[model samples]
Target: MKSILFSTTLIAFLALIPAGEAAAQLIPQPWVSVGSRNDETTFSIGARALNLGVEFGLGTEDSTGVDALAFVNLPLIDQVSPYVGLGLYSEDQGVAVSGGVQINPTDNLILGAGYHSIRGVNGQVGFRF
Candidate 1:
């Protein structure tokens, strides 16, 4: 009797959750960026959940050696929105500021070009879930 009751409760609880919400966890929303920082090549890879994003960056030889940015902007589906971020520049041992606008051409594709206080101009491509 206890086994049957437990099984029934588990089934009911699972059914109460939305399918889309559950499936979103299985889908990947990733982003990549490349550009110049301090006149050297920079690259970053990242992922997003809702409006929040976190990316790790390699700032090349001229700038800081490595950095990371954590930001919140309009969600990935939005056509255009300004993004403001705070980051760390490891070699300089200082805080980094990132700001730009991200452009979304489709539900799954994002394109961005912008300037930064330390990282300079960059173009980003991202995927939405």
Candidate 2:
């Protein structure tokens, strides 16, 4: 478990290096995301497809549960970008490391699915601009 977390963190850090540089040159945008992890409410805020972001859980079994996330987007087609992200979450079971992908259907709407160590499935919809 430690190794998995360490490796996931390492990969996320490595990916962020280029993302940070790219973000510096692009216009920053704000996005709001809401989802569920293990049937619990989840939320996130950040710029779409760039840099640092944060996510949190509401009504979570674990008190004060939260996750920090980093995202990078790749242009796939018009009005769509495929995104990859890493997340770390606090839970009653333990700290969790996770990664997932997001699909942007429109500039304002995003659909995502991912996995976490503590939570089995993650799904969310985000409004980005």
| Best prediction by lDDT | 1
Q: lDDT tens string, model 1, 1-129?
A: 999999999689557646874465346567788888656887877665444566677775544533333444344543776667777767664677777777768877878776655667888898776
Whole-model Cα lDDT of every candidate shown, in order: 0.66, 0.56
Cα TM-score of candidate 1 = 0.64
Provide backbone clash counts, one per model.
Answer: 0, 0
Give the worst 10-residue stretch by lDDT in candidate 2.
Answer: 78-87
TM-score of each: 0.64, 0.51
Q: Name model 2 segments beyond 4 Å from true.
A: 1-49, 58-60, 75-92
Instruction: Itemize residue pairs with steric clashes in candidate 2.
Output: none
All-Cα superposition RMSD per candidate:
7.8, 7.9
lDDT of 1 at 123: 88
